[model samples]
Target: MRAFDLAASAKAAAQAAVDAAAPDLVALSHRLHAHPELGFAEERACGWLGEQLTEHGFTVTAGVGELPTAFVAERGEGPLVLGICAEYDALPGIGHACGHNVIASAAVTAALALGAVADDLGVTVRVLGTPAEENGGGKVLMLERGVFAGVHAAMMVHPSPRERLDPTCLARAQLHVEYDGRAAHASACPEDGVNAADALTVAQVAIGLLRQHMTPDQRVHGITTTGGQVPNVIPEHTEADYYVRAATLAGVTDLEERVRDCFRAGAVATRSRLTLSSTSPAYSEFRHDPGLLAAYERNALVAGREFPTVTAEDDRQAGSTDMANVSLAIPSIQPLVSIDSGDVGLHQAEFAAYAARPAADRALLEGGLAMAWTCVDAALDEGLRARLLAGATAGG
Candidate 1:
């Protein structure tokens, strides 16, 4: 009996498959970029990715984990289940500023390519349509609901202005804070008004002051979703949403406790009712599997992707991702695939425009091939395969 050399022939096949699917993958990326959808509302993106998988002979289950946009697409019957995380949710107003369209496209291409050789490698390929990485923790919710039940190895590539392996990501939690007060005419009887706006002001000031006490890695930021209707009417109710980020989940937990004190201070100072609650489940920090990370670097290099020699201090990735939560339960890696976005930062409108450019399209193809090759490499390596097989199943 002769064993196939997955590192040699299988590599070429995977790359070829990605090349063959380049046109459709590019179209998918562009379509997602053109029609932006917010977190948990990625109907178009979800339907499109799922349809592509279904057309290519994958068994796709939509609306998994109680999320309308979440889906799981699988092929092959091998014991080793490889999970590909596809994030397609866009920012609130900036569209696909974080280039999740590229992420989704890459995941689909990787899954398709891997599916072609899954049997030979004795592996199962699963592409997960994970939504709402922008603001909500859709993956977190899905994980809690048992969506990622049988995945052995999970992998995804995020788009960024620069390429890097094992990039640092923060753990964060979202907070919804509100203040309720009595309303009165501002000009006529200002003294009688228990101003909700003032309460929010006190909270904002407290938050600013609290920042001084926090570590450099700790961050707290928010926006007033509803401040008031008019200046004449003293604000009866004020609401805001904030994000508290830290280097780790424990740090985020500690910071949230401190931050809530600031919110409570507003109510105490203004004699108003304070309502503060978590908007979504907390996102954990990224934990990269060293084996998967090395495989991806090698494959990315073969795909002509280069790591940056110099990166700006401020340009480093610091935002939270729901994919990080997947790492907690599965052996995973969520590396950044660099695109030529110039100096524009992610979550900015200009970055969203760059997400649809030719460079980003190239990233979609190359990142897919790299990830597919990595999966093949992992499946072929005896040690890596054994390790992955021994791990608990996350999604299949």
Candidate 2:
């Protein structure tokens, strides 16, 4: 079959499959949205996804990485292994504000749609249940455990304020800082005790000052998790959580050193001892395969969606993801699908409401069909596949 004919056939098959399953997919997305789990604690979400895939005839493997929330479901046999990644974990306190429910539903829909045409397309479809993307770096951990060792390509659609292809994601590192000091009576022996809270304040000031000298792409943000016990007593200890980001991994590493030095300066000025530790896996900048991304954009346009061109002005708002880590290792694309996010952006209550709206529901189907069609194109289009492989190998 001609490439266009194959794309149309694959799209038709994907649409049929998605239309037949739309109700259940939307319901699952809503259910997950209602009961959000954080990070590696997504037991119920993971179980439900596994059950859904198994019911659809995919061979399901649960708990692949000593993590209760991680699993893999596969169907068909072929040399090309196409992975559709699912992230079901929600943000702490904010629930599905990140629209992970949409992510899970879209991935499941794509895998099932691809599974329906796997035999004819000569491709193997693997749906990965990657948990804790908001915190634990489940994909990074799974990659380390060889979960994605043989995968040829990976794809996942994220819900955002707008649609874009191969958008740049920053490299990020998270840190937890603790300050130790001596406690004393506030009104009596205040001079005898060192204040941990003072150390944290000093650090914040230092970080704020350091921002003036950093690049425009660099980001430094943090919060104090602890301050004190009582008004009358000087706190003996305090803690703060921070995230440092840069345009690339190498830049982030260099920036991290400077941030650490600021924290040390805070500790020294406040006469408090400080300890800094990483809270999760460091996120790398996305290494987009232009060849694959172009295919994705084509498929998306065919699905009645248009991708907006990113410009310099819009660069400040992009967030980091473990998918960036996957991109560094293999061919990958992380495109955003608009879902009526309204004026509210990610990590907010209003955005969570949009995750279940009709617009989001439509995105689930369109995004899934687009992804399935892209997979079919990749497997059947020798020229595209060769270009993708060459790009990935050269980058490595």
TM-scores for the candidates: 0.96, 0.96
Question: How would you encode candidate 1's per-residue C-alpha lDDT over 1-396 as one tens digit per residue?
Answer: 134555677778878888888899999999999999998999999999999999888999999999999999999999999999999988877889889999999999899888878888898999988888887889999899998988888999988888888888899999999899999999999888898888989988998999888987798998999999998999999999999999999999999998899888999999999988887899998888888999999999999899976556733448888888999889999888888887887888999988999999988888888999999888888888888898933232
lDDT accuracy of residue 378 in candidate 1: 87
State the number of backbone clashes in model 2: 0
- Model 1 TM-score, 2 decimals: 0.96
What TM-score should be assigned to candidate 2?
0.96
lDDT per residue as tens, model 2, 16-120: 998899899999999999999999989999999999999998999999988788999999887678899999999877899999999999999899889988877
Alpha carbon deviation, residue 9, candidate 1 (Å) = 2.0
Worst 10 residues of 1 by lDDT: 1-10
True-vs-predicted CA distance for residue 387, candidate 1, Å: 0.7
Off by over 4 Å in 1: 1-4, 310-317, 392-396
The reply for model 2, stretches above 4 Å from the true place, is: 1-7, 309-311, 387-396
Clashes of each: 6, 0
